[model samples]
Target chain A: MSHTVRDKAKLLARVRRMKGQMEAVERSLEAEAPCGDVLQLLASIRGALAGLTGEVIEGHLHEHVVHAENDAERDKAAAELADVLRTYIR
Target chain B: MSHTVRDKAKLLARVRRMKGQMEAVERSLEAEAPCGDVLQLLASIRGALAGLTGEVIEGHLHEHVVHAENDAERDKAAAELADVLRTYIR
Candidate 1:
């Protein structure tokens, strides 16, 4: 998306941070950390993933749902949104 | 937690799967996939993380909140739950 290209740097930053978080989770497992500690780390990763998801979704909604110029484009956007939501909610 | 020991294998499996999903996200970025594809990958990761979080949270509630031995124990559990919820929400 055009919007995505503009946000690519920020998005990639988020991706890298998430990668670090994932590795932390793996390290915790390998070290046999306490369950409470592991749960907290997983929760942090979950929060980061949610933030990233929200960023992309906000962009999608702004570009498609809110700004579609034609009826067909709007329909396509709505359909894609539904599809994404279906997967997201799972 | 005692409950965690019982479920360690299952929990580790979830962690590993989430790690794989995350690597897919990085791969998609490296391949210059469409924004839509990247977003789909993110959504899937979110779903998996949520699943794993739910599993751990369930165990925590069952072991601590539900089966707490005394008021003091229950209160501690509640406080920890609150801390985790706050972090998860952010």
Candidate 2:
């Protein structure tokens, strides 16, 4: 199994927390919270997602890229990662 | 300004590296690099994107979430962040 799958339980916990956060956002909106308040919440949610993404990415790198046995393999991994990064960031 | 905008140059530089990495992936595919090699490359690319996402997230948290002056604001920020995190990880 992929490293992410191996760590599914931990990841799922994080996901659950994220869900709770979203629910809070809904609650705030329903209550007609200030725009600044809502915006702050949104920004936090985005950050959490980013953190989760980073963790998964780090696992993949350790399992597939950094640990690769050959130079060609490592180089290839780096290239593929770079391409995806471009699309993701944009 | 959002911290990301202020640090655009550094972010862009990283983006450029990601582009270069993608180019390498394309070249490898064209040259018939082994399947294992290609998979490794893809994994790396994903990781790199994750890294970039993390950076942006950190910036947002620092500027908008952590720096908020009130407890209510902080809670809202955290909640919103959690929600987005759920969507992102899935």
Candidate 3:
């Protein structure tokens, strides 16, 4: 789904930062930086990505599933959405 | 991703029942059923639908976001995922 420009902008900013960090991480690997520091960076990146995924899913639910007019359709839609969430939560 | 046959079957069953209920609801409206009864049915359908949506979102996160290999990509994905969950939780 298409997001608002502001939303897209914010996400892009985060992505850019992540890109820079990752590039630096690549350099660290080449330079044989401390394993602990590399692991820490990996963890930080993982957390940030998880947060971004949450945003997209939430926006989709609000715009599509919440306003569904057909009760049966809504049920189906919700189930499909929930199926995704169950995995995320797990 | 395609679901297993069992998952699809179960989802179909729920969908079918929801369809039947919605049809019955329409009939009730035509017959002027009690407002309270109609409202109660509406509530049940809404809950079921919400549950479904949660599932789909969760599934997508696990399949796509969780297994990201690139640190930059993972961070971006996670942030998006979290953005979605925040709304779901709310």
The candidate with the higher lDDT, 1 or 2, is 1
Better of 1 and 3 by DockQ: 1
Best by TM-score: 1
Q: If you superpose only chain B onto the true chain B, what TM-score does each candidate give? A: 0.84, 0.71, 0.66
Ten contiguous residues with the weakest lDDT in model 1 chain A? A29-38
Q: Predictions ranked by DockQ, top down?
A: 1, 3, 2
Q: Is the docking of candidate 2 incorrect, acceptable, medium or high quality?
A: incorrect
Give the range where candidate 2 chain B is weakest over 10 consecutive residues by summed lDDT.
Answer: B29-38
> What's candidate 3's i-RMS value?
11.4
Put down candidate 3 lDDT per residue, B1-90, tens digits, no spaces: 433243677777777877877887898899999998899888877777666555555544444444344546545655665565775543
Highest-scoring model, DockQ: 1
TM-scores, all models, native as reference = 0.78, 0.44, 0.43
What clash pairs does model 1 have?
none
Instruction: Write the number of the candidate with greater TM-score, choosing between 1 and 2.
Output: 1
Task: Tell me the lDDT of model 2 at B84.
Answer: 52
Ranking by TM-score: 1, 2, 3
